[model samples]
Target: MDASLEPRLDFVTCASPAGLHRMAYWEWGDPANDRVLLCVHGLTRTGRDFDTLARRLAGRYRVVCPDVVGRGRSDWLVNPAFYTVPQYVSDMVTLIARLRPGSLAWVGTSMGGLIGMALSGAGAFAKAMLAMRPHAGMLPPDQGIRLDKLVLNDVGPRLENGALSRIGQYVGDSSEFASFQDAVAAMRANSQTFGPHTDAQWADLAKYLYPEQGGKWVKHYDVAISQALSSQTAEELAAGEQILWRSYDAIDCPVLIVRGAQSDLLTRATVDEMLKRNPRARAHEVAGVGHAPTLIADDQVNPVADFLLA
Candidate 1:
């Protein structure tokens, strides 16, 4: 990739119940642009995942991709229990305060989509929280935060149990590799659902996923981040599902749901229901993709670009 197309790496301190941790973000385009676009990664992915997409859309907006604490260059929480959406949402709000963008939009993949839903819905509450006492590392001006547009990549209000179980098995898998090739192969095998990519593309995807560190190729994200996910009971999941649905329904902004045609996660029925529930919502499906569509390809990126830019 060209150096000019690459994003500027930065970090922001965010408060957790345990303590403060730094959340890393990659910035692209003009810093002075008030129209902001936030691109958030998946369960075990990093902010770098958006490099290709960011390159395409950066001209129109100041694109900011966050590692979503516990992944990529962000700090891991002292307590694994803090690895939930609320904590992630809080951190993102802090990032927004730091950016102070006059306008905001969002693109979130999988787990990141859930955080977007939660945060986007809490616009009024977030405004009030920031006014009083919010965990933004530093107090920022009480400017209201709202998502003018949102792109939910392969996720929705309800998650499929079987699909989630399959994802859970791999999320915290503590597999170690002796060689970079071996680690890249492992990631490709594990993420087949992300759809087709060239060999070089796969290499690029794995670069941030399993950094060469401490004499071994290990996953970038903190494996302990899955603890809270594993302990969720059926009742808890059901309650969480309701909360997500409420959030989805409450969203006042236009939403675009991107689903892989072969996805086991976000179903067609759910997409249909989302459109029915939110009049401002629409859907787009990628051919032959599953679980999620890596928004690198033109086919996937173009539609999202149109939606966010429109």
Candidate 2:
């Protein structure tokens, strides 16, 4: 086994009256270092998604990546309705309380970015947040109006056609890799937009993939998360936007939004509005990418590292 950078890995649990139980995460870094970084994953992804990013950041920050409720190693909710942001926010609050830290930095992808937004507000946990290709208004509150600009991909207002099909594949797919290198190759193949990776980068990404009972390779995440996205209605989608806007306005911390140039999930108009609302927020658009920019390559990772390190 590879030597753990963290001496110990702690398993934690949190509960919400909404009847959701979330998993907590802690990776032991330098005992005396006070800086903590929280990396959250997108919908249908697990906490392991940050393996590469976290390992790279471990030297300077105690990186904590939580498997959001109903995903990865976390418990699933009985009520799919509870999959909304309110429930997610509540669970994250419990996580922040447990960490008991004075400040934090966040790296959030897609759905995860919205969660960071919820926490970056005046009373929330994060001191700064870097949001990548965030879902425009997948929440119940962000329906109607226009949610096409928050991200930079071709995802339709209503998830249908091959989009839904593509999502289902990752929600719980059947694929296997013979070795860690195999997994990395798959990730790189899937993430060609980010460009090439060194062997080390591939290994870093491989940590997130695992073999299944049937000996098939797949990501380490929960299958039920897809249900959460399926349950949202159009009205609910709009409501999610309202919540997002509120949280955006409430955020007092530094905010950076990195959008994929080819993404249909977030529209330019919406991003413009967000910038107007939060003058403190800045944005970066990655060319030749869609929906999200996996911060694996130097082009993607360097800017993020500089932002958080600065």
Candidate 3:
């Protein structure tokens, strides 16, 4: 850890159908740097998940890691239905307008990956989205938040039901732990697919996973997020898959898909299809890891740093 590499906490207010909520983000490197990297975490995680990777590339890019609404220091949605991807995309649009980066790149894990995929193809809706904020006039209407590059970490257009079900089992779990170590242990058990981590690394990630509430360590995210996850019907899921596929097909920027070799979420078949569908895309796998590579290990971080720099 870089003793001097701590991030500045920041917040951006986002609009939702029910009302407005604040989204917290950790900003690193030079704030004036126009070349920006937006790092988003997975479901049930907070922005701190990207601390290692953000520090690695901070000198070259202004890295911003957000605790997406309903998680971390961000405000939870009044209505759980607002927890979907479209809302996330809209919130990001407002954020992009605020940053107004000269160039932009994305590093999204799991749910974050899907948000990136959706936003990459959302240019046509930019005008309407920009209307949400009057001062958003800084971003030109025609450009519409185009990404220079995108990295999809352990995610794709198609998500396996079994893996999702595995996640569902604990997504909204209301259990509280008596101590932080106990909470970390519980989180680690559910996150076995994240592959192995040093005990220190595990503690680092868990620090942002829960916050003291009622003098107990509880899950950081709004439990209602699980309500949104569970309410989706099969037809709704299929429709979303089609939309994501179309969005993925439309991406023109250089893309990288990082997968865990033993992942049950992003399968080899999906990666194969992704490569075939988009020539600008490439894939890399981390051995001995499942669902996702934490991007903290040297091998994991090196590949990502090289890809972003290239």
Candidate 2 runs further than 4 Å off = 1-8, 18-28, 122-210
- Estimate, for each residue in 127-181, the C-alpha lDDT of model 2 and write its tens digit: 2111311432222222121111122112211222344455545555445676656
> TM-scores across all candidates?
0.92, 0.72, 0.93
What's the CA error at residue 230 for candidate 1, in Å? 0.4
Give Cα-based local distance difference scores for all models: 0.86, 0.59, 0.87
Cα lDDT tens digits for candidate 3, 156-202: 99998889889988997889999999999998998898888989999
Candidate 3 positional error at 246, Å: 0.3
Candidate 3: Cα lDDT at 294: 88
Q: Is 2 or 3 the stronger prediction by lDDT?
A: 3
| Residue 270 error, candidate 2, Å | 2.6
Backbone clashes, each candidate: 0, 30, 0
Candidate 1 residue pairs in backbone clash: none
Better structure of 1 and 2 per lDDT = 1
Candidate 2 root-mean-square deviation in Å: 7.7
